[model samples]
Every structure is written in C-alpha cells, then in structure tokens.
Target chain A: MTTSSTLRPGVGDRSVTDPGPPAPRPRGDGAAALAFLTPSIITFLVFVLAPTVGVLVLSFYNWNLLSDGTFVGLDNFDRLIHDGRLLGVYGSTTYMALAILAVNVVLGLLLAVLLETRMPRWLRGFFRLSYLFPFVVSASAVALIWRFLLNKDLGLVNYLLGLVHVDRIDWLGSSAFAPVSVIIVNSWKTIGFSILVYIAGLQSIPDQLREAAIVDGAGAWTRFWRITFPLLSPTIFFLVVINTINSFQIFAEPRVLTQGGPGDSSRTIVEYLYDRAFGDFDLGYASAIGITFALILVVLTAIQFWFSRRWTFY
Target chain B: MSTATTSMSPRLGRLAARVLTFLVLGIAALAITAPFLWIFRGALSGSDAELYRLPPTFDAGTLTVRNFGRVTEQVPYFRFFLNSIIVSTVVTAAQLITCSTAAYAFARLRFRGKGVLFALVIGSLMIPIQVTIVPLFLVMSKLGLTNTLWALILPGIFSAFGIFLLRQHFLGLPRGLEEAAKIDGAGQFRTFARIILPLSGPSIATLGILCFTYWWNDLLLPLVMISDTDRQTLPVGLVLLAGRFSTGSLGTIAAGITMAIVPVLVVFLAAQRYIVQSIASSGLKL
Candidate 1:
C-alpha cells in the first residue's frame, strides 16, 4: 500500500511491474527477507485472510457448530434479501452511521474552528484534553456511564430536566428516544477525534490565503466558505469515511446500554450478526450477514472515494 | 485565530471576542468533562444514595473508601485487572516485534513479492475483525483455546496499521546512516537493531501507545472468545458487574469503572504527546 502510492507516479520503474528474471534466485536477499517477514505473514494469513475467505465461503453453507455444513448455493443471499428483520437492522445501522457522521463531521468542524480562533492560548491544551478524555476511556465505560446518567429516575439528565419543570423522559427505554440517546453517547465518545482532525486541517490552511481573501474585504463566514472549506475537503472526506466505517460496527454501545431494546429500535447490524451467529447458532446465516455487511462497507467506502474527487482539492 | 480580532477590531471589541471564545470553550469543556466528574464522585462516594443524590458533589462528610473495598470483593476485580495487564503487555510486545521486523523488510529490503506482501498488509486495514469473528471463533474452538488469554491476544498481535506506521518511519530515515553502518561491518539486522530502531523512537512510541490503548480497551474479540468469568477482561468483567448490580451498587460500579479507566488514563497522560501524535498522524495518513 505504501509502495503503490509512492510508485504510482514513476514513469518506467523496473522495480515494479516486472517480477521477471526468476531462474536462479539470489539466496542472499531471499533468506533474510523470509526470516523477517515469516511471523507476521503467517499470523496475517491464518487470522485475517483465512477468516475473510471463511466469511465468504461460510455464507454458502448451512452449519451450526455440530454437524457438517451442507452447501446451499446462493440460498443465504436469497434469505438476506428477503429477511424482514434485516430491513430494520440495516435501517437502524444506516441511521446510526449517518447520525454519528453528521455530528462528528459538522459539529466537530465547528468546535475545531471555535477552539482554533476563539479559545485562549493558555487554555487550548486543557480544553483539548477535556474533549479527548472521553475518547481515551473504554467504550463500555462510556456506555455504562451514559446508561447511569440516562436512567429513568434519579438520573442526572432527568433531574436537570426536572429543574425546568419538564417531565422525566425514559432516555434509553423508549423506542422514540433510544436511537437519539445512543447516537449522542457515541458521538460524545468519538467527536473528539474529528475535532483533532479538523484542527489540524484548519491550521494547515496557510494564513496567506485567508489574509489575501480578507484583504479583498471578505467577511468571516465568506472567507471560510471561499478560502478554507475547499482546502479542508480532503480531511472532511477522510473523517466521513472513517467514522462511517466505525459507526457501522456500533455494537458495544447498544449492547451494553439497551441490548437492542424497545423492539429493535437501537439494534445495529453487528448486534444482529452476533445474534444470528452466536445467539441462534446459525453460523451460515450469520456469515451471510457478515458478507453483506462487508459489502455495504465496501460500497459506502467506494462511493466516498468516488465522490471525493469532485470536492477533494488534492 | 486571536489574530482575527486583534488585527482589525477595536480593543473593547477584541476583549469581547476573547470573552466569547472563553465562554464557548468553557461550556464545551464542561459538557465533555461532566461524565468524568460524575463517575469520579460516584467512585468515591459513601453509598448509592450519595451517588444518586442530585447536586452531586465531593463533600468530605459523605465521602468514604468503602466502595473501593466492595469493588474488590464483589467481583474478581484483581484477577480481571491481572488478565488485562497480561493480555495488553503480551500483545503490545508481539505487535512491536512483529510489526517492526516486517516493516524493516518492506521499507529497505529489495526482494521478490515485497510489493504484493506490503499491499496485503495495508489492505487488511479495511477488513475489520468483526467480519471474521465467526471463523476466528471456530479457529479458537478448534485449538481448544477458548476462554484462554492466548485466544484474546493471538489474533491482535499483528495489525496492518502497525506495519504501515513503522514502514513509513523507516522510509523517512536518511539512507546515509544505514549505508555507513553497512560499510562499517554491520549486518542488516545489526543496522536495523542499532541504527534504524534507535532513531525511530517517536514512531515506535506512537505505534506502541496505539497498540496498548487498543488492547486495553478491546471488547468485542474478548466478548466473543472468552466465556469463563475468571478469564474475562476488565471491560467484559465490568459489563458482568453492571448486569449483576443493575438495581443496586452504583457506588461499587462506579469504583469498578474508575479502576478500569485509571490505567488507560495514566497511560494517556504519561504518553500524552505520542497518543495525540498518533491520532493526528493517522488523520493525515487516511
């Protein structure tokens, strides 16, 4: 991966595109290279590659840890398309992904810009630490802390609402509110990441460009749109794809907090996959779900990559 | 961007802008830090009543160390702590060793199949462990290693991101030093161990801290592989504790959470620069 990006622009490099002259291999480089690469290669092959292939292959069979798996060609995919539960699963997963992505990208950008310009120099590091502490802690801890905070009664959030004479709400138990609550907690945990990225992006925008725009009498918002936003598009695109990939695998939050409660209102696809695979012992169907999930990621990522070119300056 | 206000606006305007900036930052910081504060107080409070009390505060009158005792007694807290330490340490060590060696080969050596192999390493980044959990579970059961620390540690030992990071670092090193070492009767391994690895401190620290944070907080893999109570990690153990004390013991649960987060927080503070550097650098990479 590193080499391709470096090698792509080269015109006629013999080192690449030609794996020729293999009659009598030089023993010197080959032996040392083998020695260095053996451990990680073997580890990756067995743990990663084999399992990736296993996911694809297992999707074609009907197996439950007991009897030998019977091959059922394309039937799992057929079930995947028609599975009614999956409709809700995919819906919830997409909702969470888009919700979290919006918060991480937009809210994160706003916070980064606010801190970049508005925050006092003496307090910048302290504020960054405050924002990032949540991200540093375990996800389970975050979920459980919010679970406590969102409890029906005797919860800080509800108590705060009671201060204004508003009735207490079941933040995690209600179908209407669970999704919103989960998204908020997940966002709270992860938005720090986007803040950091956007801060870096904001700083990387050379002052001269903005200064030139200001010399032409551009206002704050106008200068941001004309001079800053375009240059920050690459960072924005990266955050969108990365956060989407992350949020698509949202399991621990809902699993710990709500357990897909209120009639699967907060169920994510990975939790659904866990249920089919482990809870139901339907490995074949679960593998099918995994394959479908991976495909969704691939498509989402591909769309992002394709769309990036239109707006990404680089 | 204080320069924005200072460059154009009047002194009073600049003062107002500065106040506004601090106001926004202070509010955001409070929101972000509220959970930590609540958990901290709950961890140190006398009882669940104190924990659930509105206007939660750290009053010397109500504070006690009893919850800390309950945390240890209620669950195998120390055992869980030990398991987390051992797993994270072994995984971190393995990651550093395997990733650096593979990275050195990819960065410097000229050999057949290096390009394809390097691509394979980088490509694995997109393939998350969740996708392969089922087959991986099967692998564990086949080896009869279920509920063992090895089951949790083995699959996590080598990551594509680690290899990619070290390789990037190695590529940035000046070739002169290595060439001089090579001419001065140093072997490839010697040059890598002495010349290359010594100067790659920042990259190594970044990757090491990254791996430590990852293995320390890892939940899904362990949740799937380890079913035994004594074998469970801190995150899983805390989840079990939460389920057990759902109706009571908020103080103890808060203590458990505090215990769980302390090591990670300490790690973050100690290696604060590298951890943030890791995140920032990876942002650029992506």
Candidate 2:
C-alpha cells in the first residue's frame, strides 16, 4: 500500500538507506528466520492471501452462508452491471471521499497554517488536542454521539440553531441533510489527523524558504502560494491518497447514523455491499461489489500517484 | 511563519493577523470540541429531557452520574468493556511479538526469497478488509470460531503495516550492537530479546499504541466477527445499543459512548507526542 508512490524517486529507500557501517550480512539464518516468521506467515496466508483469492472465486458463485455456493459464472458481474442503485452508491462514496478530502486537506491545511502562526505554546497544544482527540475515538461511538446530536427534533445541533432563530433542519432524517450529516461527522472526526500531519509537514519545511520569500517582499498570500504549498506537496499527496482510500470505505458513519436511509440517498458502496452480503445474504453479488470497489481503489490510487508526479516536489 | 512576517509587516497588520488566526482557530476548536463536550455533559445529565432540552444546559448542579449506571444496567457494558480490553491488549502484544520477529527476519537475517516474502507482506496492505472479510467469515465458520471472541482477535493479530513499520525501525538501528551480542556468543533469540528489543522501545511503543488504538476503536471487524452479545466488544455493543434503543435513551447511549472514548482519549493525550510523531513519520492511521 505504501508502495503506491513508487513513481516518486527515493521515497521507497528507507529500508536500504542505512548509513551504518556495513557488517557481514548474516547469511543462512533461514531456520531462525522461519521460526520467527512462522506465526505471521501462517496467519497472513490464511487471513489475507487466501481470502483475497477467495473473493475472486466467490464472485463467480451464488452462495449464501450456509450451503455450498453454486457456480454462477459471470452472473454476479452481470447483476452488478444492472444494479442501478450501485451508480448512486458509487456517487455517494466518491462524493463523501472527495468532500472529506477537501475538508481534511483544505481546512486542515488552513488550520495547520494558522496553528503555526504566533500563539502561546499552550494554545497551540490546545488546538492540536482539540482537533486530534476525535481521531483516536471509535467511529461507531462517535457516530452514535453525532446521531444523538444530529437528531432533527431533539439534537443539540438543532437546539443551538434554534437559539439563533434558525428553523430546525432535519440533519439525519432527510435526503438533503443525511449525507451532509455523515460528512460532518466523518470530517469532524478525521480532520484533526490532517491538521496534525500537515503541521508536521509544515514544520519540516526549511524556515529559510519562507524567510527568503519574505525578504523578496512576498506578502503572506504570495509567500504561502509560492513557498509553503509547493514544499508541502508531498505531504498533501500523502494525505490525499490515504484519506481518499479510507473515506471510500466509509461504513460506520452511514451505518450507524443514517443506515443509508432517506431512500438510499446517503448510501455508500461499502454500506451497499454490507447490506447485500450480511443483510440480504447475497454473498456472490456482494463479492462482485467488493472486487469492483477494490479495483476502483487500485486504479484511483494509481491515478493519484501518476498525477502526483507533476506537483509532488522531491 | 509569523516571526518571519513581522519584520516586513506593520505592527497593526501583524496584530490583526494574529487575532484573526486565533479567531478562526477558536471557532474550529469549538466546533471540534463541542460535540464531545455535549456528549459528556449529556452522559452526566439527570434525565433524557434535560439532555434534549433547547439552549442546552450544562448546569453542573442538576447533572447526575446515573446515566452511566443506566448504560451498565441496560447492557453488559462491563462485559463488553472487558472484551474490548482483552482483545486490544492481546492483539497489541501479539502484534508486537509477531511484527518484531518477522521484522527482524526481514531487517537483519538473510534467507532464500526474502525479497519476495517481504513484498508479500507489504503487498497485503493494499487489500482492504471488505475484500477478504466474506471469506474470512467463511474460514471462521468452518473453524467453528464465528460468534466467538477468537474471530475478532485472530484476524487482527497479524498486521502487514506493523511488520513494515518495525522492519524500518530495525533497519535504522546500529548493527554494531547486534554484532557485539553475536561476538559475546549470544544466540539470535538472546540477542534480539536482550539488545535489539530493549533499544527499540520507542518504535515498539509507537507500534503498540497504533495497534491498541486501532483494535480498540475498530467497529466493522468486531461487528462481522462476533455476533454473540457475550463476545461483543465495546464498539459493537454500543452500535447494538444504538440500533436496539434508538428512540428512548440518548443520555444512556451518550454515557456508553463516553465510556468507550474516555480511557482511550486519556491514554492518547498522555502519549500524544509519540503517537503524533509515529503517524507523521510513517503515515500510519487507525
């Protein structure tokens, strides 16, 4: 997964880039190595590798959980082609992912840049703590909390809006607001991560770059555009890739908060897959969705890496 | 950034920028923190009515500690909590052992097809759980492990990311220490246990916290793997509580959520620097 950015030179060299004195390479440690790797090997083979193959095989079979799957050939994929709801699911998933990427990457960049400005040390810590705390919290728990707070009639959010004389918005109950509500919950929970990563990214940039820009009479906006952002491209690239992948698999938020309700307005692909596999007992069809989603991720990630080359500064 | 700008800007402009920065940061902070605080206060509120009341009250005098009690009474909160603890702790420990040993092999030892083996481990990171989960469920059922906590624990114990992280850490370590240990006639296990492991504490802590936080907060895995209420982890139990009692008990559910998040939040705040450092450096997310 980390190897998605292989197009970037020098990013993958951490393992072999040791500057230490070259001692004799320990050869023929195969027995010990095998002993050490046995647990991981067995588990990985059974859990990860085997199941990956299993998904491809399972896609061709129409089986429920109990009985043996009957060979269905390309029927599942055919069903997938005709599944009109799927386009909507993919739309919602991509919308969620892109919206999250925008919020996380853009707002996070702004917040990170702001935090880097002059402030009390404790204030900086407070900002970081406030933002990053939710990233560590469970998504299910967080979603439940948001669900409670996003309730149209009883939620604190609506209550607070009422205090300002705004009419109550159906945060979760409506097609218009359900997706937005999920986005808010997801973004609120995760934007802190982007802030923290971007802060680290900002810190790694040499002070002299910005200083040199200042000496050239570059204003704040210009300095940021020319000096700060270009240097932060790699960080931007990293966050964009990871956050996109994570958000496309968005399940817990919609599952708990909306359950893809309001006539499937807020449904995502993974949520759709979950409904098919577990809820509807359509394992074969669900596997088709799974394989499709995985392919999209690989293709999308490869596209991101390909695009990153033009802007990602070394 | 501000200090650099001060030399070129007017004092008034700088002050305005500083204030504006804090102003924006203040609103963002409040937006981020308010939900957690509201939930906390709701968890401690005296009644559901108060929790849902407009112009929401956080009046300390009227707050009760009983919603938490209600959460416990309604569900096997402690059982779920204990299950979460057991799963997270065991998974962390297992990952430490498994990842470190495998990482050591990849880092220090030579073997046939090492490159291919390491690539296999690394390559699996790209496979999301959705792809593998259905078959994993099948495997668990075949092994008669579905609906058991083992279903939750077994699949999580091995992480390709963990091995990659610790392998990188091990590669960065000085080989002289291990060479010295070998010259002292210590076996590979003794050298790893005594020297390599001790020096790699920070990396271990980073990986340990990463795994613990991940497993503790994970919902989908437990939701799919453990169907039995007795085996359910906190996230699963909380979701069940939400689905089973959506309309009636927001306060109690808030309490359940607060309990789920607080201990982890406390530990995260305490180890904030290391966790942030690890994520920033390695791009590892829970």
Candidate 3:
C-alpha cells in the first residue's frame, strides 16, 4: 500500500499495479541541468578555484610585484617557524580571537535566554535591534566611534571614569588595554548575531517539555540544566566553530584602532601576513603564513565537527 | 492539598522567572545602546568639549553643524557615499541573477560531473579571501582593474555562500509544482522564469539584504584595491576622515562616523525581520 502511494505520481496506475517496470528519465534533463549550472560553474572556477590554485603555487616561489620568480621550496615555511615578529603576531591573533569568542558566546546566550522569557514583544524587538546596531555599521565606523569613546584625555569613557573618581587611562595607547579594547568592540558588534541564533534555537524547544518538568517539581536551574542547556548545545556548537574561524582572520578592527600596536602588542596573524607581503614585499613568506593559517583553521574546524557529534543534539 | 501546594510554588517560580528575564533583558539593552549613545553624544559635542572630562554633557544649545561641514569640505564625503551605493547595488543585482540561476541548476538539474562540481562550490567556503589576496591583486593589476570599482563589485558578486544559500531555499520548495509546470509543455527556461523566479521572493530578499550589507560596509577589499582617495568606499573614506581629525579634536571624525553608518543602519532597521530570519535560518553555518 505504501509503495503504491509513493509510486502513484511518477508511474501512474500501470506501474503501480505491475511491480517490475523501469523508471523513465525526463527529456532534456541533462541539457536543462547544464544550462542552469553554467553561470555558477564559471563563477566558481574564475573567482574561487583559480585564485586558490594560484595562492598554493605562489607560496612555493619568491615573486614580488617587480622581481621574477625564484622557486624557494620550503624556505618560506622554514622561516615561518623561526620568525620572531611572526610568532608574536600569531600569539596575539589567537589570544584575541579566543577572548572575543568566549565573551560573545557567554553573554549572547545569557541575553538570548533572558529575552526568550516573558518580556514585552515591542521591548524584545527593540533590544534585539539595539544589540545588532553595531554590526550593521561599517567596521571603520565602529573603530572611529569607539576611538572617540575611548580617547584617553578627551574621550567620554575617561570623562565618565572621572565622575567615579577613577584615574584616566590611555585605552588605545597602552599595550595592555589595546587588545582588551578591540575585544570589547568586537564583542559588542558580534554578540547580537550570536543572540539571534540562540533565540532561534531556544524557540525550537517545545514548551510542553518545560511544563512537564515543572509539574514534576523541577526547579528553574534544574530544568535548564536537564533540558534547555542540552538543547542549546547545537546552536552553541555552531557559533563556536564559526566564531573561531572568523577570529583567526581578524584584521580591520586592530588595523583601524591601533594599527596593530602600541608596539607589536596587537598584531594579528593576518596583519602579520599583510605586512610580510605588502609592507616588506615578501610574497613567499606571506603565502607560507597563509597556508599555515588555512591548515590550522581546517584542523580546528574538523575537531569542532568531531566534538559536535557528541554534544550537538541534532 | 498536595496539588495546591505544588501549584503555589510553580506560580511563584513563574513570577520570579518573569522578573529575572526583564532584568537580564534590561542589561543587554543597555550594553547595546551604550555605544550608540556615546556616538551620539560625541557627534553632538562642541569642539571645545574636553575629552575625559567627567559628567559628559550635550547641551543642545551648544551643538553645531560644524563637524558635518568639516567632513564634507575636508574629504570627498559625497563621492564615497556614491561609490558605496553604486558598488553595493551593482554587486547585489549581479549576485541575484547569478546565484538564482545557479541554485536552480543545483536543485533541479542532473548534469555530468554535478556531484564533483557541487562539492567544489561548497568547499570554496572554507578558503578565506585572505589566502587569495595576493594572486587576486596580481590578476587585478595585470587586468588593469585595480583602483576601479569593478575590482570590488566583480569579486563581491560571485559568492559561494550565496549559491549555497539559494540552493537550500530552492530545495525546500515543492518539486510537484515544478513538475506540473513541466508536464504542461513548459521548457526549462520558460518554467524557470514563469515558475521558479516568482516563488523565490523570500530567498532573494534574504540574499539581497545580506549581500547589500556586506558590500555596503566592506573595508578590507576597498582598502587594498583602491589607492586613489576619491575611489574609496565609505569605510575607507571614514578612516581617512578619522586620520585627518585624529589630532586632539574628534568632533569632525565623530560626525563623519555618524554619517557613514546612518544609511546602512536605516536599511537594517527597515528590513530587520528579513535580516533576523535569514540569519536564523542560515544558522551561521558559514
């Protein structure tokens, strides 16, 4: 009966009644498919595939804008291991990315869970919009606005600090505060996105389950631990993976805010790579860094995917 | 009696939950709004307003249009705005056409090498643009496309994410509808135009909003691609203004920042539902 119902549309009465008939191929299906896929294929090849292959090839040879190529086999990779500034840059980038991810996920989840409760509809919407406002603004604008707010002598942050009798600190100029400032700004910009994702995940959970838990006398904390928290793992897992990838690639904020330092304090890997290629005109080394960064990202993402299998409910 | 006792605790718990929820939301709201208020205050302050001075004041009487005037005169503000609008609009339009057609093929068609080709498309997502910058720049320079808006617009149009997103949306659609149209003697092209295109409004809006916002606010591409001052996008343009005003006073820079973000913010406000929905459904899977 099930087979008959499933076959009714495609095969009609004859095929449904007779258990052994060959399936018919639609006419022009191949031609039609190729015609539709042509644009995407061409675009993928030109922009993504070609450029990727180019980067891999460029990594093996020493070719700047002016000079002809010299195949310097593993030398670039070798230098990457020992370069002092490059090492510092990697440390700063990883530290900053992880910091931002931690803050954003924790705060975002908290906010999402809060907003999902009995808040007024209009109020919830307003808060969501406000949270996401920083994201919608351009990165340069965010940098400039925050710079104004954080100015040591003349900025509002210090002024506010004065009211509380706190000594003014150079938020952007100090090495210690500069990375923190970047992380704060990035978190402010990105937490909204994480919050929105969490809300969606939160909404997907059936209220009946919570109600049942309550009827069985499960307290708020208990209900959350046993029910809500586990359900939210998938969303959390997704955010962590994407956020980590994005963090490793951080550039604009540090560039605009501190130019990567009160020294080399805030130099991220991408900034380091940029300097090597454009600042010093060392393409081979830059390509090597790029390759390394890509490999790290792949490995990290794979681990996340593996861990997700255990924790991600879906 | 026991049932009554149990109900009493649950009711109180509900009340507590409500109150706690409000408190958390209020704090989140403040965190989000604080920066915006700071920006607003900075933009409106007079030139002489001392930085780091306690009790920040924005006396409406002291506010002036001086910063706006300075932003316009000192930099090519209008030109940057024009460049951003033109680049973003062109990229969005081109992506719409390219992504939709491609998505349709992936969803409905069965061609040779389709599996391998589709894998390539999805795999490209893992390759960040940073890795490809050198080669892309080299190619652009060779083509004499550097410093031109085409450099930004062309690359922005062909996104793997866009293709993947539209394909997901297309796959969710009922195949029976398209099949019925096909049975009516409609050719592939005809069915696509008369059937598929019209049904794709929601997905298109999602892609359009995402693409527009991305290109509208992009910084890295413009920074590297365009060296000429007039060719800079809004982000680059604002950075230049910031550099010009980075000397003690920030009034002009604050005003420039405000102006730069307002249009995109307004678009975000209007289309927020679509934005939120798209972001949610896409699952930040990228």
Candidate 4:
C-alpha cells in the first residue's frame, strides 16, 4: 500500500516534484490548515503546555495553597537532597520498575517466540487474548480483583497455599512483599503489550533467514540467539523506553492496593508527590518535586533515544 | 553424513521439540490463567468460608447474585456509572472532532510552521501527566471546574497521543478519493467530511474505544479533581465504597468491583477485533 501511494501523483507530490509553489507562501493552504488544527492546538496549549510551564514556574516559589508567593529558589531542591524518605521513594520506584521491566521483557519474549513457532494457530490466539484481558481492564479493577485473590484470610491465594501446606504471605501488607506484589501485578497487566510487540517483530523477520539457519544444523537456542535476537532488538528498545517511563509514573495500582501503606512501604515518587501536594497541602514543594521528576524523565528519555540509534536496528 | 543416522535423529528431535514446546507453553498458559480463575471463583463464592477454604472450593449452592444486589445498595453504583458514561462519552466525542482535524492538517495540508508544530505535538507525548497535574489543578480551580465532571472531561479531550495516532492513519489514506471530491468543487472541510472521514471509520472506532476505556477506568485525575461524593467517577466512588464498607462483608466489595468491571469488559468483547488490532498496531508504534 505504501509503495502504491508513493508512486501516485497528487498536489502534495507535485509541490515536492516541481518546486513550483513557494514553501513560505500560504497558497490558500494556511486558512484551511489552521481551521483544521486550531481546536487541537488551543486545547493542547491551554491544557497541556500551559500547565507544564506553570508547574515549572511554580516549583521555584514557596507559595502554599493559601498564601501569596514568596521566592524560595532552590529551597525545595535543597530539601529534596536532604530528605531521606525521598531517597527511599526513588529507590523503591526504580527497583520495582526495573524488576518489572526485566520480568515482563523476558516473559513476553518467551511467549512470543513460543506462539510464533509451530504452535496451533487457535491456541496462539487464545493465549494472546487471555494474557491481554487483564491489560484492557482498568488499573483499579485489576487491583481490586487481585486484592480479593490475595486477601490475607478470605483470599483465594492463601487458600490455595494452604493446600500445599505453605504459609500465607501478606502480599500487600509486608514491606518485603508489597513491592514484589506490585511488580507482579504490573507485569501481569502489561506483559501482553510487550509480547505483541515482540510478535510483530518476530513476524517481520523473513522466513528464509530462519530456514537457512535450520538447514545449517543450528539448534533452536542457537538460532534464536544468533538470528532472531538481533532482529528483535528494536522492539526491545521501544519497550524499554516506554516501560521505564510508565514505571516511574506508577500511581493507580499502589493507590488502590497499599495506599503506600504498612509504613509507606510502596510509596513511589509520584505517590509521594501526590501526598505532598494534596495530603500534606504543600503544593509548592510538590510542584518542585514534580518538576525535578519531569526533568529527570526528559534526560533519561534523551539518553535512551541517543543510545537507541546504536543498538536498535530500525 | 550417514543417511540412516541423520533421518532417525531428525525424527527424534522433532518429537522432542514438540513435547517440550507443549510443556513450556502449557505451564505459561496456566501461570497466566491462575489469577483470572482466582478472581472468578472469588466473585462466584457464596460465603467467606469458600473464599478461604483449602483447595478453593466452588460449590454450586454458594454462588448467587446476592452480592451483586449488595453492591448496588452499599454504594451509589448507578450514579457513579452514569458519571463514567457521561465523562467517557464527552471526552471521546470531543477528542474525535479535535484530533481528526489536527491529524488531517498534519496529514494533508501544506502550511507554514507545519514541521515545528507537528514536532511540538509529538514531543508532548514524552511529558508525563504528573508534571502537568499541579498547575492543571490550579487552572481547573480558577475556572471553577473543580469537583465537576468538566474537570475530568475537558483536560483529556486533546491528548497528543491521540492526534499522533490519527495523523499516522490519515497520512496512509488514499488521495484519489479526496481529489475526486475536490474536483467536484468541494472545500477542504467538505472533502474531509465527505471523503476522508468515512474512509477512516476503522481508525475512528479504534480511537473512540481507546479514549472511552481510558476515561472510564481513570482513577488519578478524578481522585485529585473531585471532592464531592456525588461527582465522583466509578473508580473513585468504588474506593470510597470500599473504605466505608470496610467493616461489612467482603462479598459487597467484591461485587462492587465486579460491577464496575463488567460493563467495560462487555464493551471490549463486543469490539474485540478492532480493539485488539489497535493494540497490536499501537504497540508497534510505541
């Protein structure tokens, strides 16, 4: 389809082909284009861009929700540097995010490879859909369902554990297991997406390449590592960037399940930001933390993009 | 190099590979399915006894709709449901109108600053919503939209990701149909409305479904914006219900969760094909 479109002639193509219409002039396109774009630009600028800039400006002030602004440049950043709990929040969020990313990428790749092999087509579709169902459900719903399944006394998980004579673990209550549980639930909800991406990547690899590897007496493991893995790197790179960003922004799951509970065991940075701004009524400080978090994300994303060019095939 | 050895080894390897693949995939399927089964059984369980019983029994007599009734009675289930519907619908409709127009411009029109503007829109995708929340709330408060449905619906109406997705779809559309309409003396808006919009039904449906689901299941924005109980969306309302009914039977809370989840699940099942395609395509883009 793309090939056919590129071959066709149109006003757009003519402009590029002949250079007859000057690029700078409106050429009656400006009004029509502006008419088409105005609503989105207005809403985006007002709702998204304005608030984004406002938050950055708000971060440098000491204005609480009640009082007028007093300049407190760098105080919030200084306080953040000294705050031990903030460090814990950063540690917990990073650890959980990375752990979940590793698990999901490995598991998703495994599933994709298996399903794309000589498996029954129907079974492949069924597994794909079943895995994706949890993802399609709301985060709140997923947390609620899991909370029921993992309840200490009346939960089904503990009940099953009893049958195996294993002790019931406080999945959400214990500091040791709460983050682990969040990671597990998050991976479960999200692994399907990574799997699909891997599937797409797997499908794009030409069949002749795999056949040649097989004809050369390469075993499945060797073929996967030597041939498929390299081809799958672009998908892996995409998943890593998206998953990292999402992990840092984790909010709904912990909010529903733990409330950063049992002594702030699952207090992620975003949740801490929420607590400060809303719970503690420290809007100025929260804005400062949020701005700092955003900057960190931007830098991380920039680094990812820079590094991706080296490793990501496409 | 021996023919007999090569033939026999190939046969044996094929059988072993088949068996191993089945074993691995079966275990993965089981692991993926366990939580779903657990949730369903708990939802169907009659008493808390069945919920905690060893081996997790699913007795026929214990399964009933009593909990479903309790869910409605314990919370303002209908009100929250209506709130979710209204917000999701408004947001989806507004997004379709605003995003399609912007997407059309990016896809079809030649204008000054097009490259810069398009880049700005795409760059917004990397900006986390958390960064914008503080001042967004301030804006909402100043507009007197706090504690109202507008706070939830308005902000979501112009998502950058939505515009990007639609623009990609529109750019791939055939130009012949639109050219035919233009030759008939149709203006750009008419050409879009008559030709491009109809041809883009599948993409439109995908966008609508995604936007609806996101708003329907959203918890964070509603949590921050809404202070009034009556205006709370379903997720927020359910959380409040769980807190209030903390001392009550677990059945009611489970039922409320189920109630909140079922309608969306039904919608998804009905639109499973389009929804799945959207996820697959969008997954690749990400």
Candidate 3 local lDDT, B1-286, one digit each (tens) = 2233455687675676677677777877886687777666666667645323356665678777777788899999999999999999998988887788778878787767778877887777778788777777777787799999988987776777888888887888888888776555555666677788899887788788778877887787887789999998898998888788547557777778878867777777888898887766556333
For model 1, residues B161-274, the per-residue Cα lDDT tens digits are 889888888988899998776556455566778899999887887788768777887788889999888999898889988877867778888988988887777877786766
TM-score of chain B of 3: 0.91
Where model 3 places Cα greater than 4 Å from the true spot, the runs are A1-28, A161-167, B1-20, B50-53, B284-286
Docking class of 3: acceptable
Backbone clashes in model 3, listed as residue pairs? A154-B51, A154-B52, A155-B51, A159-B52
* Candidate 1 chain B lowest-lDDT run of ten: B1-10
Ordered by DockQ, highest first, the candidates read: 2, 4, 1, 3
> If both were scored by DockQ, which would come out higher, candidate 3 or candidate 4?
4
Report the first chain's TM-score for all candidates: 0.87, 0.89, 0.89, 0.87
Question: Each candidate's chain B TM-score?
Answer: 0.92, 0.91, 0.91, 0.89
Which regions of candidate 2 deviate over 4 angstroms?
A1-27, A162-166, B1-9, B284-286
CA-lDDT, candidates in order: 0.83, 0.83, 0.78, 0.79
Tens-digit lDDT track of model 1 for A1-314:
33223322321232343334323333546645666777788789888998999999999999898976999999999999999999997898789889999999998988888787644565888878778778878789889999889988988999989989989999999998898888999999998878887887887889999999889988777888888899999899989888988899888899998898788899998899998988988999999999888888778877988999888898
lDDT of 2 by residue, B152-235 (tens): 888987898899888888888898988886665555666677888998887888888778878888888887787778889988
Q: Between candidates 1 and 3, name the one with more favorable lDDT.
A: 1
Record all residue pairs in model 4 with backbone atoms less than 3 Å apart, i.e. clashing.
Answer: none
Error of 4 at B233 (Å): 1.5
Model 3, position B9: C-alpha lDDT score: 85
Q: Is candidate 2 or candidate 4 better by TM-score?
A: 2
